[model samples]
Target: MAHQGFPRGLRILTAGEYRHVFDNASFKVHGKGLLALACPNTLGHARVGLVFSKKNVRRAVDRNRLKRLTRESIRLGQHRLPAVDIVVLSKRGAGELDNDTVQRQLHGMWRRLEQEAKRHLAATQSIA
Candidate 1:
């Protein structure tokens, strides 16, 4: 079986790395209570960053739950995702969502991001 761990390499560890995606995001995927901004990368795999603000989540426990869910969702779906740096931002209502609802929304967003990435790849390839 293929290893499906959320390794350090798959995480946006540094502030500089997160800033790179924030500044150069070319694709935006929005869901009910989440927003994912992504930019193409040359790393040949996808990476993710989470920004669950204290004001938005209101509790450390809630924030941690959201982050865990987000990481798990990304880990399972990473194979289908393109090589991009994705930063996921939680909105005010995100903490209220149930696990199932959050997972569904995340899956939908991933699909949208995949489509956008494919279109972008094709467009860029055609121009080159």
Candidate 2:
């Protein structure tokens, strides 16, 4: 089995980094329990930021679990994603979802982000 680690470089660690993506996101994908916003970056790999607020998921353990699942999904699908900075925000009631269901939703969100990224790039290129 291959080991795939989620390195610090592939994360949005600072508030500024999160704000930058939020302010300049070029594409967005909406899901039942998740929302993904993506912006192209000069870095040659995709990076991710997670926003799981207490207001949405009151329990610390539940929030942590969601973050873990999100990071795992992103790490697994990173190769398929473009070089963009992505922010995944959890909506209210996300903590109520089962692990398998959350995993499935994350997978779908990743695929949608990829498609949206491609479409955004194509549209920009055509306009230019």
lDDT for each candidate structure: 0.93, 0.89
For 92-116, candidate 1 gives per-residue lDDT tens digits of 8899999999999999999999999
lDDT of 2 by residue, 12-61 (tens): 99999999999999878887788898899999889999999999999999
Q: Name the lDDT of candidate 1.
A: 0.93
Query: Model 1 segments beyond 4 Å from truth?
Result: 1-4
Worst 10 residues of 2 by lDDT: 72-81
Worst 10 residues of 1 by lDDT: 74-83
RMSD (Cα, Å) for all candidates, in order, is: 1.8, 1.6
Candidate 2 ranges with C-alpha deviation above 4 Å: 1-4
TM-score of each: 0.94, 0.92
**Pairs clashing within candidate 2:** none
User: Taking the candidates one at a time, how many backbone clashes does each contain?
Assistant: 0, 0
